[model samples]
Target: MPKVLVQFAHPAFSRSRVHRVLLKNCKQLEGVTVNDLYEQYPDLYIDVKREQELLLSHDILVLQHPFYWYSGPAIIKQWLDLVLEYNWAYGPKGYALLGKKMINAITCGSGHHAYTSEGHHQFPVSQFLLPFRQTALLCRMDYMPPFIVYGTHRMQQDAIEEEGLVYADILSGLASGRIRPEHYGGLEIINSLGHGAMS
Candidate 1:
C-alpha cells in the first residue's frame, strides 16, 4: 500500500467539531500518517529537514484543514512557504516533490450555493483553490479536486459522521488502488502506481 501523509493544521483544534473527527477516522487506518502541525510545532519553529524527509517518505500528501476566509490557516501557509524551498521542493534541481500527489480535505461553513457566481461568495470553490493547485503543479505533483464537506454551518451529527467515513474511505481506496480509472477523469491526479485517482 502507498504511504500517505496528512499535514493537518487547525489553530483551534480543541474547539473543532469536524476536522478532529476526520483526523480520528484517518488515524485508524494503517499506512496513513497524520502530522498535526500546530501540535508538533506550537512555537511555529518547523524542522525543515525533518519535514522534507517526511515528504520524501510518503507517496501521497494531504492538506487537511478547515477553510478559513477562503484560504488555509496561517501556520499551513507558513509550512508551505518554508518547507517547499528553492533547490528542494521547486526550481531547477528541486525535483524532490516531482510527480507526487496532493489533495485537500476541507470543511466549509457555508453551503455549496454560497460559493457559486450567483451565490454569496461569487465564485466556485475550485476557483478559490487555484493557488493550491498551481503550487502542486509547480512542484510537479498531481493536484486533485478537494474532498469537501460543505454546509457545516447547519450540519447534523450523522452528516458529519458520514462525511468523515467517506473521507477515510477515499484515503484507503487511494492507498489500496481500488477506485477505478474512469473515476479519475475530472480528477486532479493519476496515481503513478497505476492505481486510480490521486488522493
Candidate 2:
C-alpha cells in the first residue's frame, strides 16, 4: 500500500460543516496522515524541513481544503511558498518530490454548474486549479483530477455523510493501489471514479 499524506488547510475549521466530516473520515483511515496545517501552525509559521520530510516519506499527497475564493485557504499558499523550495522541490537539484502523485480534495459552496463558463463563476473549477497542476508538474509529480464536493452550502447531513464515505473510499483506493493516477486521464474530477468509472 502506498503511504498517503493529506495536507489539510482550513482557516475556520470550527464552523465548517463539510470539511469536519471529511476530516473525520480521513482520520479514521490507516496509512493516511492528515496534517492539519492550521491546527499545526496556528502562528502561520511552517516548518520547511519537517514538511519536506513528510513529502519525502509519502507516496501520494492530497491537498484537502475548502474552495475559498476559487482557491485554497491562506495556509495552503503559505505552505507551498515556504515548504516547496527551489533547490529541493523544483530546481536542478530538486528531485525530492519526483514521481510522487498529487491531487486536490476540495468542497465548493456553489453547485457544479456554477463553475461552467455560462454560470456565475464563468469558468470550470479546473481552470481555477491550474496553478496546483503546474506546481505538481514542476515538482515532477503526477497530478490527478481533483475530488470535488459541490453545492456544499445546500447539502443536508445525510448527503454530507455520504460524501464523507466517498472521500474515505477514494483514499482507501489510492492507498491500496486500486485507483491508479493514470486512470484519471481526460476526467474532470476524481469523484467520477466513485461512480463506477474506475473499472
lDDT of each: 0.83, 0.91
Candidate 1 per-residue C-alpha lDDT over 80-126 given as tens digits, one digit per residue, 9 for 90 to 100? 99999998988887679987888887889999899888999999888
| Candidate 1, lDDT over the whole model | 0.83
Evaluate residue 88 in candidate 2 and report its C-alpha lDDT on the 0 to 100 scale. Answer: 92
What TM-score goes with each of the models?
A: 0.91, 0.96
Candidate 2, residues 113-169: lDDT per residue as tens digits?
Answer: 999888999999999999999999999999998999999999999999988888898
Model 2 misplaced regions, further than 4 Å:
195-199
Candidate 2, poorest ten consecutive residues by summed lDDT:
190-199
Give the candidate number with the greatest TM-score. 2
Over 4 Å off, model 1: 180-182, 187-199
- Clash count in backbone of candidate 2: 0
